[model samples]
Target: MTVHEVHFPVRFEASVEDQPGPLWKARFDRYWPAYRTWFLRTATVGRPTYLDCRRAMRQHMPELVPVWESLVDLAGGGDVEARFLSLWCPPPYIGGCTQAVWLDPTGHEEPALLRNYDYAPALLEGNWVATRWLGPRVVAMSDCLWGALDGINEAGLACSLSFGGRAVSGQGFGVPLVLRYVLEMATTTREAVRMLERLPVSTTYSITMLDRQADWATVFVAPDRKAEVVRQAVVTNHQRDIEWPEHAKATRSVERQSWLAARVAQPGSAQDIAMALMSPPMVQDAYQRGYGTLYTASYRPRSGAIGLLWPGSEPWMQSVADFKEGQRDIVFPPPPAAVGST
Candidate 1:
């Protein structure tokens, strides 16, 4: 049997609060340094101006404009900080993920979303957040400050994302903030799909959405192509087909997609699905290559509960209604060099 080459240790924390106040400001203070680094990584190539960001937000995501302004003030109102909060037309980044909508054959277990978020630990924000920013409560894994990686809203809408395998870039909002907007506004899987259609996303990505009404769909969106909402139970890194062979190969997208398709077709407990995500194909161990399975997330929309799972540990459970602020110290097995490339 083969495993990893080294250990990547990280801290995972959770925060539940209503509307930005003290906690939100404190979060900005803590993560601003790292967020600034990520926002400026490609600064040599001329980025957008603060006015450009605000104008784009007001034009496309008008409802979030107020929230954006408030967050900017909370972040100390620096020009760079305001621009990054807008998340408009940011540089493209890569990540690998395997996500599926799992349903019980006998209609016993909760209709759920299972996913493995694969990315470099150093780049991971690693915070589980529950907040009531707009109206309904939203519980999500935070990415770029206020952006959501995967989340469930109080209205019984849950969704997760996988980086669509492509190297395209364009004039649009970063996918993370787009996802945050969806969770904040949309209430069902269908509505989430509609929201994706009108939004100008900066890059390619696959979004799997599930609602408590037993409705689900995987919407494939990209800056360079038309967005398609497919009746897919599973999605891994690509769209209808692998347009980027190198990325698809490195992430084992095809293999993971096939494995998950079969895995979800069978009847199993929620634990079974989560375990599958934590296993091979669905899981990646290529930390040295800037990709790895950081966590396996199980979101039950009906209950608004999220099971954050990691190997060698019990799941840390959270919900939109019953969120308990906590933290986990995780030490992942050291990864091999370019584990995804093998």
Candidate 2:
């Protein structure tokens, strides 16, 4: 097992308003079918959100209709697909996501989502453009994953989704695909929570989200539709403070959490917090190797200041994104590239 950590320095012009949500829909139009099929075979969920999302795609993006339908035959679960479609709709209430909006501790929620991309293609095709073959305009950018590990978004909405080490395998469930959905479809913590509730998820795992604004929270969903939250503020690997079933025999999430807590407190400066979050240690567990233990981020909304600390690799990675005037710079070697058009 290998763990890789990457830092992103996002630059946003004051002229740019809120990031577009339809951009995500466009991405779904191209990639949703493969993902949906994967989910039907692998994930578990309580509501029909996943099915609804697929329908939305079929109507809005006709090109993907066949691909989506073909997945049913490929997975040989057309009945499941039909069942999901029958119950899908907009949810009434979404849960709370753990998010910390650092308004400069003064007032500045203007910082945009800093883009960071990391992944293991063998586990998940790293070159996002590969998704484009599914259709024209299909691009997977600014995402992170180790095989099927976890990632953060351009909006600083980061998540560490893990397969519960416990070996309680259920029906066909696709986790990676659903994770992609969370990042692509949801913009806020509440929306992310709804995405989890409405969709079907395979396997028992935990998903954590942290927007650039600093708000952060974790949700643990089981294959049985029963969901719990790790409401103590932040989440690491294993889980704590929440009463949820463990997916495996041995989980280090608690140890990782303690390791991080000892390093940084809640009410600290962005720099100190980033440093504490950047520190890394070793873990013999296969699931965590190369995975950065401490992932620190600070957002000064007043000045649109965003910082990231990823010390998992030999040369610790650090960077800053100043959204005030649309400027992003990296302090580490092998600087990050400028945002490009797909």
Candidate 3:
């Protein structure tokens, strides 16, 4: 198998108020075209009104109101609907993540989370930013959307996500924003589960949450606004059973779930688990455009520490207590050339 390396440059910014004005501007300019295209295409029919989304956020996650308002201001008060749609509209189903939670049954070691975020190859070349929200002191990764794909909060809560192997879409918020809400508001896996249960997600998604107390839950949320909590340590794209037949047939969820289950059943140290995330079945190859393992992140909630790894670089570790604001560039293996392209 060929290995394709992709480089991601990390940028750290203080609270929403402190982020560079130009930063938001550049992001908006680059992604607005794509965002508009996606919105027009997916939300043409059965789309939720702006008022509906606002009401849902206020009713379920009032804490994010101020955050959203701040984002609106940063967006220069233009295309307000577009901004809200980014958070409310259902994005195209992007899958291919393998996440697991390892709890020390003896309580002698800290619990850890391992995950590989896979998506379209175009996203790999996009400007992905990792911001540390000063208001809540949360560190998270996001793209053009102002939602978090994964993050760890100062409260020692860590959260990550995978596309639920389903084709259903509904009248709820995007899962990425929901993940951002959990990291900012919840302090334990139990609390996170509560928020997941309450908030309505527009699509099916699997969220794996771990906290400092070694408590964890993998919740499968459907578009119908129902959520099921799994106590097991491993989760892939699918729920307990494949609810979406077409999606199941298209993805390798069965194989990946089995691979993760077999690996977690064995007794291993934290390093062993982390290593497993960087290898096959977990770390995916570039099978299609924008569909490969972008990066693997390991979070230790007990210490509020996070380590990031890619195809080549050594693991980089940072903790909330000792985080320094700066930027670092990561270079990844280039994608394979197209069949007939020069």
Point to the candidate with the largest lDDT.
1
Ranked candidates (lDDT, high to low): 1, 3, 2
Question: Each prediction's TM-score against the native?
Answer: 0.94, 0.46, 0.84
Model 3 TM-score, 2 decimals? 0.84
**Which candidate tops TM-score?**
1
Candidate 2 lDDT over residue span 232-292, tens digit each:
4434434434333342113344554565455434544444434443323212212232221
Worst 10 residues of 3 by lDDT: 333-342
In angstroms, how far off is 262's CA in candidate 3? 1.4
Question: In model 1, what is the error at residue 267, expressed in angstroms?
Answer: 2.8
lDDT per residue for candidate 1 within 10-119, as digits (tens), equals: 89999887788887888789889987887899883578898888889988889888889999988889999998999998878889988888888898888888899999
Residues 146-230, candidate 3, lDDT per residue (tens digit)?
Answer: 7778878888899999988877777677888888888878889999999899888888889999988888899998777579998
Candidate 2: worst 10 consecutive residues by lDDT? 90-99
Clashes (backbone N, CA, C under 3 Å), per candidate, total: 2, 36, 8
User: lDDT of each model, Cα atoms only?
Assistant: 0.86, 0.38, 0.70
What candidate 3 gets wrong by more than 4 Å, as runs, is: 1-22, 43-46, 80-86, 105-108, 124-134, 326-342
RMSD of 1: 3.5
Q: Give the Cα error of residue 116 in candidate 1, in Å.
A: 0.4
